[model samples]
Target: MDQPTRPSKTIACLSALIKIGSSQAYALFDSGSNTDSMTPEYANAIRGPRIKLTEQVTLQLGCIGS
Candidate 1:
């Protein structure tokens, strides 16, 4: 049987909610959003092959702004 391949580096994410004075604060530690939230500078820091969405999708629009 062929063994699975392992990446050179591993990524992990942790989320927790802590009670504050009058509200709860969410704490997130991870690579960050998958939807490309990193700045151009930070994106260049990654040292691996990056996959980007290339499919062109059509979005249906209803009459609203007219």
Candidate 2:
């Protein structure tokens, strides 16, 4: 059987960049070694850690502060 591919950290990093409107490249460090998943600006906006407890998919929506 083929092994499932884990979600790419690059994907998340790019997402954060797009969301933040930044042109620079970003990297997503592992959650195990990283304290947070968002950019510096986004880190402050998070109320708390967001955990996905199931296989259910969902969308995260938020506005970037200008």
Candidate 3:
């Protein structure tokens, strides 16, 4: 079996999330990633308006967990 790859470097930083238009606060974290992304459920719950998709494109996702 292949061994999982490890991150080259690890750094700790303070995280902060701000609302789109208001001064309210919100935060979503994923230990696996330091990128700024949110789950669909969380987005939908906090989204303001919806933009209809004009195209149908297939998406392929990688393994969700190691």
Candidate 4:
């Protein structure tokens, strides 16, 4: 029997300093990512606008089950 081939991994990351509400923060940029996320504490600290979702959505992280 033949074995299935694994997909190639491509990782692209960049470190940058960004400004949020007059505050500067170090951030990592991923050009190939489909979604972006931040910690709940950081989100609250940024004091940015929040939108309530009509429905709950689940996200699947690579190598880490949701």
Candidate 5:
């Protein structure tokens, strides 16, 4: 079996309450992250214009290949 990979560095995060449209939601802010993400349910709950990506992209969370 392949061993689980470990994170190379510690990531800093902060908890915050933010407004999306007229609704407020609790969120985590990651200082080390270069990208933004949210749950599919949350995305659907908020009112906004969403842009459909022409190409799907994959991201490595925490560390590379994680």
Candidate 6:
């Protein structure tokens, strides 16, 4: 079963390109989104500490023009 959809609304968001360690990345800001995502290359480039989570998460994104 699919989750109930929320009302789609257009809102202003802030996005910026910032340097993470040596590499740079585009950071997205979405107040309505339930989850955040990043590429493995970016994470590796940062070389931050890794912590194992007790639970895993699933990220679902709707395709354009469904």
Tell me, by TM-score, which candidate is best. 5
Instruction: Give the per-residue lDDT digits (tens) of candidate 4, residues 3-48.
Output: 5775656444578898877778889986778877777788788787
Assess each prediction's global lDDT (C-alpha) against the native: 0.51, 0.47, 0.59, 0.75, 0.78, 0.75
Off by over 4 Å in 1: 1-11, 30-66
Measured with C-alpha atoms, the lDDT of residue 24 in candidate 1 is 53
Instruction: Please identify model 2 stretches exceeding 4 Å from their true place.
Output: 1-19, 37-66
TM-score of 2: 0.18
Better of 1 and 3 by lDDT: 3
State the lDDT of candidate 6 residue by residue for 2-65, as single tens digits.
Answer: 7677666744468999776677788988778977667777677789556687999777777876
- How do the residues 18-55 of candidate 1 rate in per-residue lDDT, one tens digit apiece? 55445455656446334323235434554334567599
For model 2, residues 1-66, the per-residue Cα lDDT tens digits are: 876788777345322333334334355444444233455465445443556657864545445752
Give the poorly placed runs of model 3, Cα more than 4 Å off: 1-18, 23-38, 64-66
Local error of candidate 2 at residue 17 (angstroms): 7.5
In model 5, state the lDDT of residue 2: 86
lDDT of 3 by residue, 3-58 (tens): 78767575445566777654345664556654454457655766645557798645
Q: What digit string (tens of lDDT, one per residue) describes model 5 on residues 1-66?
A: 887776857544578899888889898876777888877778787756688999997976665666
RMSD of 4: 5.6
Best-fitting candidate, scored by lDDT: 5
Better of 2 and 4 by lDDT: 4
Residues forming the 10-long window of minimal summed lDDT in candidate 5: 5-14
Q: Estimate each model's TM-score.
A: 0.25, 0.18, 0.37, 0.57, 0.61, 0.56
TM-score winner, 3 or 4: 4
TM-score, ranked from best to worst:
5, 4, 6, 3, 1, 2
RMSD of 2: 14.6
In Å, residue 66's CA in model 4 sits off its true spot by: 11
